[model samples]
Target chain A: MALKPLGDRIVIKQVEKEETTKSGIVLPGTAQEKPQIAEVIAVGPGGIVDGKEVKMEVKPGDRVIYSKYAGTEVKYDGEEYIIIKQSDVLAVIE
Target chain B: MALKPLGDRIVIKQVEKEETTKSGIVLPGTAQEKPQIAEVIAVGPGGIVDGKEVKMEVKPGDRVIYSKYAGTEVKYDGEEYIIIKQSDVLAVIE
Candidate 1:
């Protein structure tokens, strides 16, 4: 099953680092204060949300940095994804 | 000094219950999960915030119920108040 976000929300999945590291080392991401990086999987049509005008800026396949505490975790078809509003996205990674 | 909220934000102070109850019993609000009731002290101008058009609805002296965890606590002149977005307010008490 595919997850389709509603409103100004978007679904994103953490972009896993390459498993083959140059030093063959793996560092877990839980011990840092850095923002999370994820790839957008689905984009919602933006309009009026909560009486506010919202325009969707990110699209599917775009890498983005989002607020640390934002987004709701949803499991779909045994795959985990985060659903967050466009406002929660801090920036797009070029 | 007075606090001036910005961008659809509002400064509110928790409404203190009457010191004397009919039964002379006092119950602290922290023990419950009920939404907090606050009185608006300052209101910001409705404008664009984070790329979204926001219109301020509540005014000073209005009583409102806001999202339980949606405000920032600020201490000014030894008085405590909460600053939150207007969207955080769920309802206004008539």
Candidate 2:
């Protein structure tokens, strides 16, 4: 199922948390902290300001990094999604 | 001292975390989670997109709510500031 964000909101599918520590120790899901990486799945049209529409810079299919605790978590189609404003996105992965 | 943000960036001064709980219980600083509220102090001159500039909808002095972990923290003049994108702002207080 595809979900579209309204005005300037972006929906992101979180990348699974790393299962292993840098030392190669595996961590169970219950022990994992919040995931900070995501894949952009949908984007909203630019937000309106003073009667002018602003367009977004990022697009769907982009890999992005966001703050671990940023965004509102929502469940859709049994999958977890994060809804955030375009500005909440820290950077687009190159 | 005041700071100016570049294009599409906003500088926010964190609103001190609630010192007491709703039930009148006081929580210590170490027990406090991250702060999610802030006041807008500076705003960037909208981001450049396709060579056109997008003006920001928020301005200085607006009370805003942002994701708890949404911004880059910086310190200047003994004050902490968070720099975020306009999109990261969840809402503006009237």
* DockQ metric for all predictions: 0.03, 0.03
Docking class of 2: incorrect
lDDT, candidate 1, B1-88, per-residue tens: 3788888889999777672233132322232223456789999997888877776767899866555465799999999999988766
TM-score of each: 0.45, 0.45
Q: Give the Cα-based TM-score of candidate 2 against the true structure.
A: 0.45
lDDT of 2 by residue, A13-74 (tens): 87665632332433232223343567898887676733357579888889786654445654
lDDT of the candidates, in the order given? 0.67, 0.64
Q: For candidate 2 chain A, which ten residues in a row score worst on lDDT?
A: A23-32
Worst 10-residue stretch by lDDT in candidate 1 chain A? A19-28
Q: Candidate 2 overall Cα lDDT vs. reference? A: 0.64
- lDDT for B92 in candidate 2 is 51
Q: Look at candidate 2 and give me any clashing residue pairs.
A: A87-B87
Q: After superposition, which runs of candidate 2 have C-alpha atoms over 4 Å from their true positions? A: A1-94, B19-35, B47-52, B68-70
The TM-score that candidate 1 achieves is 0.45
